[model samples]
Target: MSSRISGPGLGSRSARRAAAVTPLLLAVLLSGCSSGGSGGTKASSAPSPRTESTATATAPASPDAAAYRRWGIDKPLAAPPAPPSAKLTDGLKPGAAPKVIRRVPTSDKVVFLTFDDGAEKDPEFVKMTKDLKLPFTMFLTDDIARAGTGYGYFEQLRGEGNRNSINNHTLSHPNLRTLSADAQRREICGQQDVLEKRYGGKPPLFRPPYGNYNDATLAAAGGCGVKALLLWEATMQINDMRYAQGDQLRPGDIVLAHFRGPSELKGTTMTKMVANMLRSIERQGFTVARLEDYV
Candidate 1:
């Protein structure tokens, strides 16, 4: 959830200098979510939240230069509307990037619970998963997903029959958007290759570090056999000492949480967050579903 994803043009003097001074930005974003069930494990150290944002920003600037020049126009491209829901597919075609899985269930009240950047699996989280029987989506990073580490935790989740998945968050958690074409391929495809080998199945989905991406970022993701660009519709943030996700949670909302920072991990401690999230969902009279099942 909170890891760095490197991209090109992010290593220059200006970028490095900016990076050094960018901690303040993280402080601003993380300070509010540092405690309670709201923080969770994906809540990496404060100021390091740039992990995903920096990577997603690596795309070549002036993406529409040629097109604009052709039309003798010079203005920023409009923000594209949300993509429609679609089925997941495998393999990459030339110039194709990952397609956005806008929301798993557009009509159901069910919520897709997702955790990112699992530093390690916590027994507490696992227990809660078993107790609640909540299905979740884990966007795994290479560090904890490796053999002899958090791998067993992943297996445990599957053994418990938790409706969840392990998708690529990138091998080193570098922001693929910031990397060069080669680096993007390395981060995207490289992680896919590793997860396939280590996890026994490659993920068909990807989440750019920090939910940040542009046209080029999406293209790169698609080129690597990633079909779905996963993003959240809502986030649980601290309201005083408790976590809140809007006035009333709804059906079909993708709620984001974390399990890779100072306070929590996937196995146990992270369960508190999931428990709270599940309770919220139940309160809304909606059930939790596997992202794959719905998407």
Candidate 2:
């Protein structure tokens, strides 16, 4: 999750100069936005396939009117600051290949579901996952874990029988493109280490925060043993809430949702968000399926 600071605090000529330089740097960072990377074939170390899908989503309502409003998301109590470690790197190196994963995509009846930032274990999510026997993938970040909302709460959900898998999302959620090569590896590999210690083994897939990453990010990811860098095909928002993708989403599409939020409107709990998504998908003539079926 990215942070937004409103109003003016830091200012003056130096601030303006710093701000002026940001866009030029941002251009470099944004260059990673392309679905294809340099030379296509996963850059030397053989980075995994990083396919992305884009959709036109109307920005949901701001979080301010959430309390009295029924259709908007509740604004985050305070604007979040950019994650503390969003630095950029220029060095590059190859890493290990993560385990090859398989999905049930050929069925044309199922879809994969992925959630980013396991900020907390929303009971509604646990209940829904259990009740529906849904399979959802979590791309975890240590900061979220350190924030006290780690995966410990969902031990049972991650057990052998459960269809959920916890993957690495980076120790600190940085825009991988912005960091130096070594720093990029540290972010990716460091999180993999964290996942291994906490989840009993390291994750095979890596997804950058906010879908952000550059070739350096991918190269570093490959060095860290990640076979595939996952991306989403679509995200659902209803009554201004986000949802678990597969619950009511469809086949071949990657569904994206979040663990916490700077809500589109206030009072928008995880419960309402998931509900909204399910309703939206069902209305679209498709159902959400576990990504395992796809690839």
Candidate 3:
């Protein structure tokens, strides 16, 4: 319009138009900014992409990953299969001498770890068992286990739920094969009493010292309420395992290890030795199973 408009009405209309356009302009600006404007100065509360990726990459995949690393294991140990419902005793009979077994009779790719004598009670080993939820059997000798704080040490290993078992080794670590019938009975039965009184309930399993046994030893064990005489298919030493027949582990093999420390293991801790043993088992694709669950 060529004509000039000068009045309060014209001023009011211009103000209204400006007021309406102001909101539209502001809304357009906000929409552009929210659409990832290059000049936007807004800071985000969310983590950056690189930070998120790094976090995911560094996170452990398993709850036991740290534990496996701490124990020098490359990977977490495979879990054993569910225990048999009826619990196979490997043809154990009642009212007779308990059957001696070097290995459990099963087709599963599992092996049993058993510790003997209870000579060295390393606190770390107890922690390891709890950390790994490891299952093993202990054959304790009265004289050795009861010695100077040894019983208390083993009591720590015997945690709740009875995940592990304590069986009779002997009153004294003696060659039952060399002892007389009465003497064998005394040794076997004496420890039975001690274990029953100390741990509660008679043990269903027994292992003669040095794996040396005779008819007299079996008879004594049976008389003392022992249901099975456990021997081993392999003996785990500080650095390696000694198999009875072959160089490899067989399914259901009972692996014998000791409650030993640096003194007995040539400066290797019991936990470290166990870690190495577990590595060997892992390498062979075998898993650890509870001996009590089977026998």
In terms of TM-score, the best-performing candidate is: 3
lDDT of 3 by residue, 96-127 (tens): 66655667767899999888777676788888
lDDT of 2 at 271: 60
Model 3 stretches with alpha carbons more than 4 Å out: 1-63, 90-94
Candidate 2 stretches greater than 4 Å from native:
1-107, 240-250, 261-265
- Model 3 RMSD to the real structure? 35.6
* Model 3: lDDT of residue 293: 66
Deviation from native of the Cα of residue 1 in model 3, angstroms: 99
Whole-model lDDT per candidate: 0.49, 0.48, 0.65
CA RMSD of each candidate after superposition = 17.6, 14.5, 35.6
lDDT of 1 by residue, 107-169 (tens): 655666676665545666665454444456777766646534456777566423334667777
Question: lDDT: which candidate is best?
Answer: 3
Residue pairs with backbone overlap in model 3 = none
- Ten consecutive residues with minimal summed lDDT in candidate 1? 10-19
Off by over 4 Å in 1: 1-95, 160-162, 238-246, 260-268
Worst 10 residues of 2 by lDDT: 10-19
Relative to the true structure, candidate 2 has a C-alpha RMSD (angstroms) of 14.5
